[model samples]
Target: MTMVRLDDAMVLGMNGAQRRAVREALVVAYPSRGRLEALLDGLDRSLAHYAADQLPLPDAVFAVMAGAKAEGWLPLLLAEAVAVTPDNRQLADVVGDFQVGDFQVGAATTGRAPTTPPSDWAVIGALADEFPDLPAARPLISQAGLPPGRQPAWNVADAETFWSEVHRLLVDGAVVDGWPKVLLAAHRARPANPVLAAAVSAAGATGNPGWREISGRP
Candidate 1:
């Protein structure tokens, strides 16, 4: 069977609307709804259809998982969960057979940056300032070599917007260490940031509700 996949563009396109739809669907799919494994199974089963009445279930499921800041093992776990499904069964018995100890949910990484820069000098400079450790940010900062406190008079508002894109890239799978902590710093820098909020909310939905508590919001 072909495994379901979510690409960069699709994951980046997730928004509040899709998140809400998935949540509602989950409530119905798993009424007991306590286990993360069950939720993962439901999501995988839902995606087998991929589309229902024009609503894209895979996109919504990916939106939720990516927002959750799941580790690199997520794809591996999903693959394992789906693989065990009985050919004669309707829905999978993933949760019953799942053995968390059998898998390692290690650090997530997006691999590398593109050879070509995607942002303008000002935006890149601002990102470098914000996340100096980021792989993509480092090269831009080096090439521009804009002195400290000498960045172009770019619009600060646009920096916030761009930071959302950066957040998406990181959580979606960057060589991030302590991803939750990184998210906290991002939220601190930009209070009420939608992207940050979405990221936090995603993490909350997937058993790790720490982001919600740290952000001090429901």
Candidate 2:
């Protein structure tokens, strides 16, 4: 309940109630024309801090931001947020959730409904551009299909050939060639396939060198 300033590190360690209290304090302090700007600035600083440290931001931050989104400035605030930290995956997700109007959890699920006219296709397009390999961005690309050239054809003759291509792409260190996108596409097509799921999981654990080892690379 203390009114200390909430920063990325401080918010990360707070429990849900404590986080809520901080958000409430923010609302009280910035009650007028400054409200949305203050909220967006805090969010930008938090996201920038995490991105600079190369660390993952916790869901708590997004939870509070979602609460703010319900106050009817979702698009403008989120668009500016994403513009400031486009590479932040967690921020991308918050934008994606509102874009699709999927407010199943967090403060968004409370009695306060999200403002109508959810994020438009332009915002979704920006997210897809920043995170082409992210599964979250895939669906937002277009109902017709994945983005141009990024889509894997998956036209192999057999299951073995399909997996062979996947493995080759991984082992050859073709990550820059969009191998992760291919792996994610495969997982989406066959969500029940354990191997595909594991590959997607492994691809995400990029810190582990085992997945990046090239047999003969100098």
Candidate 3:
């Protein structure tokens, strides 16, 4: 069989008016042999804009933004959730799947900062061997269910955003350990810093209905 692949936009119906408008803005709204970067900025704008009304967390919209080039311009993509299961934890494996190096969807970055840096398509159990106490580490490894590397390490990348994403996942209960008592305890004990206070509050509110507004633009 002469197999063929289908574009997510097509099946998801990005050709419609409202969506088309957003797509046209991104330029890659339709497939072409053009620079993928061209559509990235526009996609970022549309996702951010529409997210205010209805979060871009819908599968179609989420795929468009989450799958974009993450490294060169890291600011564009945010913590968009793809699905939510019965579990109280917000469904955001997509965020953990991302990498600062390769464009793979379910990649991970682990280990001490300024050292391990980042790796693509991580297996959480193996990565957890280092931290030993990171609640979310192994779950991330098992959940991503990564196969043998489709693309081997070209070289280590910055992994800055990757670290943050994983941390957010850990705090939100995406990982196995997902220590709320530890997190809340530390959060409460923090110095009476306003910024930290706000951070703590925001951290507490993830996966809430009200906060869904910018869920995709998270």
Candidate 4:
């Protein structure tokens, strides 16, 4: 299996809103400590590059750093960067907030970024189109849990089975990674299925409660 690098510039060039949406999706889909560290490191590198070149820092950088601060690593990670790149005025200004305790370290370590929310389905569809090869980019039924040789019929039986499996996976604390995209893919496949529609809706609801539950699983 080919692994996509998180720091790909093409992926990073998304407009502020889209980039934030994708980052939120990634946090929910892959909540491991290692994954979080990689993301933080990527953000650090991007910020350092922007600082080194004196390029205007993208809005997404602050947004992502805020997320890392809330995750409790921003202070430590930014401190390291601040130590290494003292001449990066922009980086110094951002890290100053953490040093002065303007931002609070969150009690919780992992979750969505606190900001304007976007439609999960729309974001998934857009990302899938924009970055089709990335594992988390496409939320196809085939990637969720469809059995081999079976196509997504979106029939009642298919809908019920799919929903049941997803519910079971979530409740059993299984690693249902990329499930949000999977649910959205199902909704797209059968827009009229109440179960799927509701699941999709719930997945994108305020604070993304459904997604939090899924991501909370081991």
lDDT by residue for model 4 over 157-213, one digit each (tens)? 422343444445534544344466466565565454333454566666335544443
RMSD of each: 16.9, 16.4, 18.7, 17.2
Q: 64-142, model 2: which lDDT tens digit per residue? A: 4564444443344444544544433333433333343344212244443332221212222222222334354334222
Colliding residue pairs in candidate 3: 79-218, 97-105, 97-106, 97-107, 124-141, 135-177, 136-175
Winner of 1 and 3 under TM-score: 1
Tell how far residue 162 is off in model 4, in angstroms. Answer: 6.9
Kindly provide the TM-score of model 1 when superposed on the true structure, using C-alpha atoms: 0.21
Which tens-of-lDDT digit does each residue in 109-128 have in candidate 3?
Answer: 44221212111222121122
| TM-score per model over all chains | 0.21, 0.21, 0.18, 0.22
TM-score of the candidate numbered 2?
0.21
Error of 4 at 127 (Å): 24
Error of 1 at 32 (Å): 1.5
Residue ranges of candidate 1 with Cα displaced over 4 Å: 34-36, 39-67, 70-218
**Local distance difference test, candidate 1:** 0.36
Clashing pairs in 1: 68-202, 68-203, 110-173
Q: Which ten residues in a row have the lowest lDDT in candidate 4?
A: 1-10
For TM-score, candidate 3 versus 4, the one ahead is 4
Candidate 1 positional error at 168, Å: 48
Q: Rank the candidates by lDDT, best first.
A: 4, 2, 1, 3
Off by over 4 Å in 2: 1-46, 51-117, 121-126, 129-218
Q: Quickly count the clashes in candidate 4.
A: 0
